[model samples]
Structure formats: structure tokens, C-alpha cells
Target chain A: MSSSSPEQLLAEIRHHCTQSWTLMEVCGGQTHALLRHGIDQLLPAEIHLIHGPGCPVCVTASERIDQALELAARPEVILCSFGDMLRVPGRQGRNLLAVRAEGGDVRVVYSPLDVLAVAQQHPDRLVVFLAVGFETTAPATALLARRALLAGVPNLTLLVCHVRVPPVLHAMLNAPQCQVQGLLAAGNVCAVMGQAEYNALAAEHRRPIVVTGFSAMELLQGILQAVDQLERGAHRVENGYRRAAAEQGNHAAQALIQQVFHPIDCQWRGLGWIPGGGLALREPFASLAVERRVAPPVSAPASPEQAQGCISGLVLQGLARPSACPHFRRPCTPEQPLGAPMVSSEGACAAYYRYQR
Target chain B: MCLAVPGELVSINEHHDPLWRTGDVSFGGVLRQVSLACVPEAQLGDQLLVHVGMALAVLEP
Candidate 1:
């Protein structure tokens, strides 16, 4: 058999799509990649690719954004976070970017550690870092926190939104609307946490979870591997990203994360709280925890303006597709994003908008 | 799993807040982000673990 193109793969999958498969990619990066590469359009109409809330910005609750904004407003605190997270809306439809526009000391940083250094060198400013992302990102925050404490960077604090992938997957599997036969796990997260966590989930759920790289070839491989497992009635964890991920992930990073963070309840945009699917800075590093210092004061914790006309939450939950949203293009463009998915570079809406629109 | 490799910090430049000084780390032809905030002592050419735009450490050369 010759190697398959995404077009070829989609054509073949369409043959079985009508009655059988619903492969969900559990990372927003994959969602962006698929849509940006036009992998979504290349696919046969029969097969479905559901987007997951792997985007740190898309899944982050409004209350957290408010807290970040509040931190940014303080004269001593310069709030730093991933750029896309800056645009995520809060209580009154305000976001970090909006707050920045209003002259708050908000800075966009690539890593949690960068803010730590700022905190260390400045000594005068409180560098309250907005820590976001999943297990793949938690390590950096953990390492940064440890480093800050070691360096006596008392001015730095972490606004942690570091989420866990496995528990969310577990929640999805148990959700009433759950409709997945296989998974394309975000490869970066596995690089930090390893594929071992997935093994137990696979054993329990009897669903194939293919750890995948961002490359198109790796994605194709992951999809094919998941299909093969489903076809063979075999449920297990497989790594299509072997070069970067091992059965045991980055042990050093894991050790850092374990030392600084403990599982806690986190609010997801659509999925709500999954009890222990998120992280909080442990007692030793509690000083770096932003959640402890700030209280989010949103009149209504759940606000509709925060969503606007965007059905991204539904798209993330697999209830709908980006194209399926009525306001996808007319109202939701990347420059003027109506939803968080359009706001972030890793967002499916942004990817689809940039590539397809 | 995309190859999230280690990058080397060359130098930092900032007036008020410090900017990351990590070298251009090639990742499958796409350059990734690493934070230069943690490695306070990282001089030019100090290798660091770069992930999702954050530098995790001053790694082995």
C-alpha cells in the first residue's frame, strides 16, 4: 500500500464514516492545524473531527480573566500572559487586552519564567504572571515557581490556569453528549507528562488514544493508528510522536510540576468543573498563587456577552463544528473575534478563519 | 509530540521589563518560544529548555 495523502485518507475514511467513526482531536493546536491545513475541508463529509478545549484561552473561565485584569491594574503588578489570553473576555465583556488598552500594566509573555526574571531583576515591581495551558504548560510554571522561590523573587506570582488533559478526557467520556470513538491527544502535553497517564484511561474506556505531533504526517499517522485500533477492536495508548514522547515523559519536568502543584477544581468554559482536573500552587509555593490573593467579582459568573455569537464552546465540546456556527464569518473574524477560539492563534476558529476564510 | 527542544540564551535587552534572550531555536523549521525570565544568570549561549514560548532552564551545552 502506498503512503496516503490527507485527501486520500479522508476519501478512505468516508467509506466507513456514514455509520461508524467520530475521531476527536483532544488539542486545540491540532484543531488549528487541521483547519489551517484545510485538513477539515479535505476530509470526506461523512467523518467528523471534533475540537477539544485544549486551547488554554478558550477553556479558561471569565472569573480568571477578571482576576488577571485586577492584578494588571495594580501599580506594583505587571500582569503577563500568553498574548491570545490577553483578548479573552471577562465579567463585563472586558478582557486583558481591553484592560491593557485602558492603560493597565499588562504584558504578553511567552513563558511563566520570563515574568519571574522580571520580578527578580526589578525587585520593585510585582510581576504577577498569568500561567495558562495544560499539562504541557504546567511544567514551565512549576519550574518558574521553584526558581522564583529559590531566587527570592518575592515580587512574582502565578495566575495559574494549568489544566490536566486526562481528567477532562475522562469527563468527556462520561458526558451525556460524549460521542467519540478515538482521540488524537495533543503531542506537546505528552512530551511533558508522557503517554503513561493515557494507558489507564485507555484500559478503562476501551478507546484508542493516539498521541500525535503537530505535523500533518504525524496527524495522519495518529488518525490512521486510531482507525486501525478501532477497526481491530483494540483499545490502547499509542504514540505516533515517539521521537519526542516516551512511555515515561520528561521526568525532570514532571518532578518540578509535582513539587509545586496539586490537583484542584477548575472551571472550564463549557464543561464546568471536573473536580480535580486543574492545578493550584501547593503550600510551599502558595505565595506565587494569584488565586489566593484575588477574589473574582463577576455579578453573574456565567455571562452570555462573554460568548457573543460564538458557538466555540459547542465546537470545543464536539456538539458543533466551526463551520457549523452561524456567526462564524459574518460576525467572527480573527481581527475582531467574537469568541475566544477566534481570539487565540491556536484556536480552531482562528485557524479556519485564517486558512479557509 | 512536537519536538520541544532546549534553546540557548544569548543575551537580554529591555528598558523597563527584560525581554527573553534565547537564540533562534529551530523546531521542525518552525521557531518556538522560550521565556528568558527564569535564567537570571544565563549569559550568552546558555542552553535552556524552551516550551510553548517559555524557557524552563539553563540546560547542558
Candidate 2:
């Protein structure tokens, strides 16, 4: 790790930034940390930081949320998910909490393994874990799937909605309106999946990709590194959070994730579909998928945000600011969220609401 | 959500199968049981970056 302090890193960034440059931080956690610590404000006006669609809850397709609500409502099924997901609005403004309110056995779990315990306790009820996250959270869910399969926990099933970061970044950069000149990748995800994918992305897109952590110091260092690269007209992947991330990442976790899940084209709520963007259970583990047990509802082609008048799609793509939205603090407060971004703590909208507002 | 915390591994529950090994990790004063399946080489007192009850990586001291 660099010995430079946060102030030193900020100074370096300011000195390096001679021209206007737009950089997108591709993780909601980083976005939250940047705003929460006032790091964005501390940066030179030449360095523009745009938040990416890194919040899994914010990116999850409403069709999946509606399906989760459907599964939660089933009398014999107990649907469990992270608390961040419970408030995400689905079809007709319904959510998992609403299903729970109507006496559906929808439970909030801190960990995916907790769902295994819930399954063991209620042997008769089907426990479906709504697995949603990026590479960082995927390995844990993969471990859960492996453990369940090995221990013969037949009652538990996973509604896997885990996504990969690289493809989404590719989609974002490919967009005509994309203003991002460089990128700060999610460090925790890099800690698990490593920097190989990022190296490839950087070389292909010709943009600096810096793996960043969620601390003020780490975020500033990542910015400095990106700015330094941009100033030199050099594009490469740099590990700004070397303490947690590695070049190859955690091999054991990667092996387990590879053994259990395979890439599949999946939908992002507002971003639509991207090929190889999500993971699905493979072969023998496929039996543990919730879709095998319960039928999912046919969803409309339109994204939920369109119907709700939420411009989260544009916001997520870094084309619009959260505060610039007409519905930002009006009918779209956290108490009554019209979209998932407003509900998830890591979301840019929520960060803007809490800190920037 | 990819939120993880650095916690010190206070104790390990060794198992015949390495995949079943677990440990008690302390974050601040609170302690929770975390899976050590990924980091089978993890020893007691090692700081681990834990995410959703699983240790993804060991932080360098």
C-alpha cells in the first residue's frame, strides 16, 4: 500500500488533473464512501466522478423481484434474502415486505448460510434464498450451494440472480452517451475475482481501470492513480487496494464459484440484458434452483422504472444525476421508494439522498 | 451488496474435511462464526475480510 495519506493522495490527484476527465466508480459501496466522506467534493473540478450500476439490489430486474414476491407468497415456501432487497418495488408497487405483511413467510437473512439453517429447521417448508450480488457475494452463495448439496439439504433452493461486473462495465462504456473516461473498479469484487478481467477491459477499452477500496484514503488513492494514468495518456489496470485485492484473487473461492455456477445472459433492471452477465447453477447443482420447484410469472418486456416514472436506468448508466431526477425527493423518498436504487444503501440515489441532499 | 469487514480470527473449529472447517472471528467486540473453507491455511489471529459469513481473503498484516 502507498504511504501517502488521504490528503496527499487528493493533492496528487489535483496536481495530476490538468484537464476535465470523467471517471466512473463501478461499485455502489465506493460511491457511498466517496459521498459519505465528502471525497467527491474534495476532488478538483476537472475530475468528475460518476456512479455506476454496482448495487446488485439496484440492478436486479423487477421481473425477478416480482418472481421473488410470487415465491414468497406461496404457503409452503419461505423466501429469504438480504434486507436491502425487501424494499425494492416490483410489479404494481409490490415488494417482498408487502408479501411478508400479508403473512407470507418472507424472511431477511444476513448471510446465505442462514437460509440453510432456516431450511433445516422447517423441513417441510421450501426455503428459497434470493441470491443477489456481484462476484464478492457470489462465492459465499456458491459455498452455500456446495454445502447444501454435500449435506443433502433437500429443502433449500437458490434463486440465483448474481451478476458479473466486467460485462456491465463493457455495456456502460459501449453506450454512446457514456461520459466515463476512466474507471475505479470495486475492490472487494477484485479481492475475490482478481484483476485479470480488469486488465483485459483496460487494454480493450483503452481506459485506466483502478481497483478501489471503500475507505476515504483508498478511494482517493484510486482516483490519483487513474488521474495519473489519464494525464500520461496511458491505459492500464492498477491495484489501488493492494491490501485486500491480489492479481489472481482468492483461488479457492474462484474454484468453488466455477464448480457451482456458469455464466448466462441475464437482465439488469434498467440496463436490460447483457450476454454472460449473470450466473446460473450448473448440472447437478441445477436441481437446487428455485425455478425447478416453482413456476415463475411471465414478466412484461418493459422495465419497471418506465412504468413508475423513475429514471434510474439513465442514472445507473451515469447519464443522469440522482438529484436531477424530477421525482428524487418528491414521491420517491426512501420511505416510499419507486425504484430499487432509492432502497439500497449502496445505491447512488440513496447516497445522494443521505449525504448530498 | 458487497460489504465486507476485516475481523480477527479468534478461534478455529478444525474438521476432518477441510471444506467443513470454521472459525470464530471478532469484529470490534462482537464475535461471529465464519467459514474458513476458502482460506484453509488461515491461522488464529489472522485478520480476514469476511463477507456474508464467509472469509473471502486474508488481509495483509
Candidate 3:
């Protein structure tokens, strides 16, 4: 929108887009940035910046939403989750927001703390919070779960859908066609895991792992650094966002996550299975875990319904980009999104539609 | 899973990681991290974006 912008620098970068540099951004927020600002068009097509499966909604398997719906419809269960999960269709056009519309007592709370107040107010209602998100969100959920235990609020229970950030990164690196040379590491995930984890990734993969921010300047600089490293045949961990992130991430939050959840192999939507990639509530908190209480997942994926055909899985896995998807805009607009990635405010395709051509 | 931004210190506790902090960060929702670490000297209303569990960086908001 102005002169002296990153646009001026774009042409120069494009010239160096390299014979083969498969650079991917590992956060869904970054996907929105690349698409929203039309940075995808601004950059050289030779440099493929694929969207990673960092979007929590995009990766949330079908069974989870079914459980949310089932629990929401229960008279005593007051389900709470972030706003994005509402639009995602689980089975038979049903979503948590739909459950709420049907008057099953579903409310949107900005923070996990809000659930605490709801528990305080309702005393008798079995308020089950649908806690879903990545490391950034895990702390709040962990804190609330702890608070529920300490306060002896038998009515308040959290259905943890918290996932880790690093294991997926590891999965991406190990893919067969994984020509990935670098990554714009999610700043927030790094904030929790700290710079320590990336050191191994960078060394193992021999790629520059630039912990990048979501700003225009931050992303531009991050791309430049990533490109620069690849061009020079260097591999290491770099911090594009150093102001808040340190060598050690939030230890207290880490401690909380450790106490509440244990690492387990979870199914990813596109990539299928990544061993030890997800987190589940610990045994001590078995009563709070939704999987423990829910009946067998009745609303499992149907044969024909299984093929949503959003291509978000391929797009997220870096095998395909949003523009390449024939259904990107036609079938999967943000308002009537066909998949979880498009449903969220941070969705890449939605951002591209709103800001990109 | 978590995304973090950086913040400045509003007030700190010599005994605990700062006890209180207040800042309007760029993140969605009324985001606040009640936890603090003493190694990173912070003051009242300093901004920090946190993810998973660590405070990543101070944002220029």
C-alpha cells in the first residue's frame, strides 16, 4: 500500500527463488499472512511456501467434533470452545455452534478463565469446556483444569484437544518428497518450546529454522534470512523474533502442560499418523477427559461424507497450495467453509480471498 | 499449539515471577499471561506473546 515496501524487495528475491527451495511456514497464522497480503503472488512462484498443518481446527479429527456435538446435546453438559470450532461440520451437517442454536447450552468464552466463572455461576450444571488449540492455548487450558481440580468444582471439566507443535514439524521434515530446506517456525510455538527444540531440527535437517513473527516486516525479513541461508548452503536456527522468545520458553507453562497431558500418537488429517505427535489428558485427570465419558463415537465418518474434497489436507501438507486447489474458493469460502482450515479466522484460504486477488 | 507475543513488565515480584501484568497485545481475544519469570526483568504492562508455555518475544505494539 506504500512505496519502499517489501514489494520493492520482492523482485530481487524472486530472482533468487533457487533451483529447488521448498520453504514452508509451519503456522496457520502465517498461511493467512502469505495469502491475505497477497504475498503468495508477490513472491516468486519458484519459491514454494506451502501451508503447514498448524491450524488446530484443520487438524482436529472427525471423532473429536462428534464428541463435542454429542456432549453439547446432553442436557447437563454445557460445552464451551473457541468460536472457530462452531462452523466446522463434523457429521450430518452438525457443529457445536449448531448444537448451541438448537439450545443445547453452548457458549463462546474468549479465555478458559471464563469457564471458571460459568462453573461458579452454574454450580449444578456439568459444564464441559471443549479445550482445543496448540501450545499457546495449552497453558490456559492446563491452568483451568488445575483450577477445577483445586476448587473441587466437580461440575467443571475440560475436554482437552491440545496438540503439540514440534512433532508435526518433525513429521514434515521426514516426508518422502520432503525437499524442504527451511521453515518459518511458529513464533508462539517456539515461545513455549523455546529455541532449544529448533537447534536439533536445524542440525538434523540442515535447514535454517527462522523463528518468525506474523508481521509484514517480520515475514519479509524471515523469508530473506531463510532464502539467504539456503542460497549460501548454511543450516542453523535463527531468531527473527527475539524480543519475547528466549533460549528457554515459558517453563511454568511447560510444567503445567507436562502435568496435565502425556504425549501420544494422534491421527493428523492429511498426513495420517505421526507417532507421539499429540497430547492426551493424564490418567489422574481421567474423569475430566471426554474420551473417558463419551459413548462409542457413533457419528464416525460416513463413506460418501468422508470425501469433503476441500484439499486443505494436501494444501496443509505442503504437497499443494491454496491456489492450486480447484475447490479453494468455489466450494470452500470462509462463510460456508468446507473444511476446518477455511472455518477459522486464521484460515489461509479465507485470508487470501479477503486480501489476495 | 500455543502462540506467544512479547510484553513489557508492569510489576514484578522479587519472590515470584512478576505477580501482575497488563498490556493490550496484538493477539486475538483479551490475551494475558498471568505467569512471569524473573530472568526476564519486566514492569507493569509490558507485552509478551506466549505459546505452548514460553514467553517468546516482546512485541512492538
Query: TM-score: which candidate is best?
Result: 2
- Candidate 2, pairs of clashing residues: none
Specify the highest-lDDT model's number.
Answer: 2
Best-fitting candidate, scored by DockQ: 2
Against the true structure, candidate 3 reaches a TM-score of: 0.86
**What is candidate 1's lDDT per residue for A1-357, written digit by digit as tens?**
225576565555554344467788988778767776777677655556777778877788767777787778777778888778877766556677777787888887766666766776777877788888888788777777877777677777787887888888898888877899899998878877888889998998889999987767777778777877887788999988775666677666677688899999788875678778888888789987765655654454556444365677677787876778888888777776777777887777776777874
Residue range A147-266, candidate 3, lDDT tens digits: 677667777877776777778888888888776778999877776668887898899878898998787766776787788788888899888866555668767667778887888898
A20, model 2: CA deviation in Å? 0.6
Tens-digit per-residue lDDT, B1-61, candidate 1: 1224665554455324333233454444565545554344556666655676655444444
Better of 1 and 2 by DockQ: 2
Q: Better model by lDDT, 1 or 2?
A: 2
Q: What TM-score does the first chain of candidate 2 have?
A: 0.98
Residue A24 accuracy (lDDT) in model 3: 81
What value does the lDDT take at residue A259 in candidate 2?
92
Clashing pairs in 1: A114-B37, B33-B53, B34-B53, B35-B54, B35-B55
lDDT of 3: 0.70
TM-score of chain A of 3: 0.91
Q: Give one digit per residue, the lDDT tens place, for model 2 in A1-357.
A: 364588777777777789999999999999999998998888998889899999999988788888898888889999999999999998678889889999999888988878889999999999999999999999889888988999999999999999999999998888788889999999999999999999989998899999999999888888888988999999999998888998899999999899999999998888989889999999899999998987777774555678768999888998899999999988898878988889999988999999955
Q: How well does candidate 1 match the true structure in TM-score terms?
A: 0.84
Query: For all the predictions, what are the DockQ values?
Result: 0.17, 0.87, 0.34
